[model samples]
Target: MRLRRDHLIDLRPLTTSPAFARMWVGSTLAGLGGQLTIVAIMLHMYDLTASTFAVAMIAVAGLVPMIVAGLYGGMLADAFDRRRVALVAASITFASTAVLMILTWSGGETVAWLYAIAVVNSAANSVVMAARQAIVPRLIPRELLPAASALGGITMGIMVSVGPAAAGLLVAFTGYGWTYTIDLVLMSALFLGLWSLPSIRPEGAVVRPGLRSLADGWRFIRGAKNTRLQFILDIVAMTFGQPTALFPAIGAVLLGGGAITTGLLTAAIAVGAFFSSLFSGPIARYPLHGRGIERAIIAYGISIALFGAVLLAATFGLLAPDRIGEDSANIGLIALAAVALAGSGAADNVSSIYRNTMVQAAVPDAIRGRLQGLFIVVVAGGPRLGALYAGTLATVTALWFPPLLGGFVIVGLVALLVRLAPAFRAYDAARPTP
Candidate 1:
């Protein structure tokens, strides 16, 4: 019984903080809706363009706006009430999604409209995410930060897993209109969560959102070696390791089963995250968060490399069907690839738990929003860069080559970066320092 208890996720944060619980529930539901829209958009673009590069460009298009919003949103979070900032951002997201739904229903959604709306959605979401993340440390106790982060993993797991799969099925059967409509309905939950929260102004010297504020945040980060190192490590891992941009093509040509395959491949990562968070009790007890982050990311790189190997095997006619297309699939290879992706997801979640806890515990409240904003940029921007990298490389080379080569690049780069930053590897959770 004790062993079982030790291995289970802690529930105290939810039971102890009703406000956090309400917010978590709202975020989870709203996140599921967000995923629906994201996957739907990808599928919509692919159907219209039939170009993998075009599909990848969706994320790329939003990169600049998302970065700007994240940084400025962080400053807003610091200067204004976090709850209000989040609410305003959520409102923007809701309105944009409504526009998407209306356009799809009216048969007026061109590729250009889709791209523009996606940029708006992504930009607004960055602000919402920056504010929401900054709010977590204030709501929960310091000791429960890891558990809270694990719970966040669970939210992500459900959102990505169920949302993608559902979006695919909806787009396949009900068409894009229904998918967008469902997302529109789910976005309402975010308002509930944000509206229920009390006003949470920054606890320290607040910095207004602008050039001077960004400079101050940058100065703080420059002095905070451990925090800075974690950002670099995350960038390295994400830049080389992300292969999501290739999923659409992989499903169509390499793996088969079409939209279903894409959805399954994407959802597999969340499946791993969900289970990892479900059994995260032991993870919270580990003191060396720095070491944990390093080891987990290394494992993530290995898993991604293995996924590449699975794709490579498919190319060699290993466990492959004679004719692969939307109607048929290489189940064996798909399963292997899903397992590899799931492993990567689990490892990434573990790294996130440590990184989030470190940041929340180490950074002061006054600067926490700005720092988290920067973190959001790295978090969101890294994947955008990864999409461009994978998409361009795959366009020139082969589908399997990007993850295969990029995985090793991540492994080597992360190792070198960590070795040089002794302070990051030596970070102790008990005595948190930025």
Candidate 2:
């Protein structure tokens, strides 16, 4: 296929709005730092407790609080200036990272302290994320939303690809204190992004940030069939398809390269996301967003199933038994697993592009913050649930079983949901309607 320049990631958003560009750069850097802290916390928890379950608990602990913060933060974005709301959220994250660094540097780090700080950080970051997403639509035209989302994907791709790799190395060479310190330093970029933006209060009738306001957002969502379906579809995709928490175990028991394998597996997904965004010209041109999301999620489910198949193959003695240990690596199985993960990553990014575009285009500006808050909750919460699902299932059955079964579940459930939502299947980007 002959690729045209327009098929690539459109850079119009960057040139059109300097504020958006600065925010994009700042958000990207800050996000990279956030990833560092996330990976570091997991490694730190594992070191402190020496248990994978304990590490998993870190995410589980933060899930509820994060949901709360996302909802409240979205309200705040709608009520006050979005710039201020984002700055406040970013400050909270900065302070949390600083505290984390201090604890590590002063030799006062403990499992409880780690858990407490991590939960706080997660809650704060969710707010920042919601505010940021809400702000993007304000900065660019509706037609350019897909491009902006693709840019977001590139930012996420870089963060995930580099941050974890950096975390592993920094932890190995410098120590946890230095690693945390680096994140604290990198977070300064976020201030620049938020500072450059103008005050952006939500248009239309503003409401107080309370249950009533939240209920109003819910009312809108309830009435908006296509929007509701997109949310449900995303949850289905994330809940059943996400298998991130199993990477360490997969690397140690199944793929046999320990941290290196885990890093590779994680980065492979990010690489796919990055490449997909880099060549997102084709993605941005597509107008049938509903069908696009449907097809993309199905592909995502298939890729996850393929990854499960690879793991199952390893269990069936496709790889040498002796090579199935941290000390002895199975290069071939690791390669296959990475390929499958990459495929999943690519498909998931495509779904996200369409889903985000639909939300930004269809929803009213007045309630966009609240809806975005709920969107953040679904996006953040679904993966945590998936992590729990994968970990529990793997512990109960075998490492290969969770993704294998979960993948099929995603495929089946998503198909059914899309079938039931006929309007979603007919959604057109040219005439976006909630």
Among these predicted structures, which one has the highest lDDT? Answer: 1
Sum up the clashes in candidate 2: 2
lDDT of 2 by residue, 1-434 (tens): 35667667889889999999999999999988888888788778867865666766787889999999999999987888888899998999899889999989999999999989999998998889888898999999999999999998899789888887788678756889988998988899999998999988999999999998999988998899988888888888888777877777776677776666766777788888888898999898899999999999899899999989988988887865565766787788788888888888888888889989988999989999998898899889888878777777777788788888888988898899989888888999999988
In order of appearance, the predictions have TM-scores of 0.99, 0.96
For 237-304, candidate 1 gives per-residue lDDT tens digits of: 88888898889889899989888888899999999999899999999889888889999999999999
Error of 1 at 154 (Å): 0.3
Report residue 41 deviation for candidate 2 (angstroms).
1.4
For candidate 1, the lDDT comes to: 0.91
Residue 78 C-alpha lDDT in model 1: 92
